[model samples]
Target: ASHAEGTPGQAVAKAASAATPLAAAGGANHGARAMPGNALPPYPEAAREDGLEGLVRLAVEVDAQGRVSAVRWDARSGVMLLDIAARDAVRLWRFEPARQDGQAVASTVRVALQFRLDAPVGWVAQADTR
Candidate 1:
C-alpha cells in the first residue's frame, strides 16, 4: 500500500470488474472499445526488487480516430516507477473510438491497471469506467 519515495516500477490497483465501460458519455451504447493486443508496459525491475505493488489510475483521452491523444495520472500507486509504466503503456493503446450519433467522437475515460506479483505479466490491466 506504500512505497519509499522515488521507487521505480509500474503502478497498479485492485482487480477490475469485467466488461467495464470505457466512457460515461452515451454509456454502453457507444461502440468504442480497446483493440486487442495492446502491449502492456514491462514491470519496472527496480520496483520488483523492492516487492512494491499497487494500482495506477489514469485519465486517458482517446481521439475520434481511436488513437490515444493524451494521458494524465488521475491517481498514483505511491511508486513513481509504477505510475510511469502505466502512463507509458496506456499511451500506445488504440481504441475503437467513442461514437456519438453513430459518428466517432473524442472522449475521456479512466482506467485502473493492477500490479500484483501473483498475476501473470501484463494480465492485470482492466478498463475502469468510474
Candidate 2:
C-alpha cells in the first residue's frame, strides 16, 4: 500500500503495481452494464509495489450514481497482498451513471489490470526495493 509515491515518471509503474491481485477465487461479480457510457476506470490504488510484474482481473458493480458497488476479485498471480490491494482500491472508483430510459440505473463492469515493472531492472530504488 505504501511503496513508491505514484508520480508522472512512474505512471506505468504505479498502474502496474495497482493491478496485480493477491488472491485467486471464483463467484466474483463481473459485469459492466453500468459503465456510465464513459471511459474505463483505473485500478483503485496506483501505487502497488511501485511497479510489480503481472496483471489482475476483477469484477465490480457500479451504482446508479456511478460509484463502485460490490467488489469481488481473485488474484491470478497468487499474491495475497496484491490481490487485496487491488480489490480494496477498485471498490472506491466512481463511474459515470449508467443511463436507462433517460434515468440512472445500476450496472456491473469487469476490469483487467496490467502491471508492467518500470523499476530499474538491476538498480531498484529505495522505494521499490521492498
User: Which candidate number would show the highest lDDT if scored against the true structure?
Assistant: 1
lDDT of 2 by residue, 67-117 (tens): 776877634545554456556656766655444445666765555544444
Every candidate's CA RMSD: 7.4, 12.8
In candidate 2, how many clashes are counted?
13
Q: TM-score of the candidate numbered 2?
A: 0.51
lDDT of 1 by residue, 1-130 (tens): 2333233443222233234343444454464466765666667788788898878888888888989888998889999998898899889988777676667788765667766655533333333321
TM-score of each: 0.73, 0.51
Q: What is the alpha-carbon lDDT of model 1 when measured against the actual structure? A: 0.65
Candidate with maximal TM-score: 1
Evaluated against the true structure, the overall lDDT of model 2 is 0.42
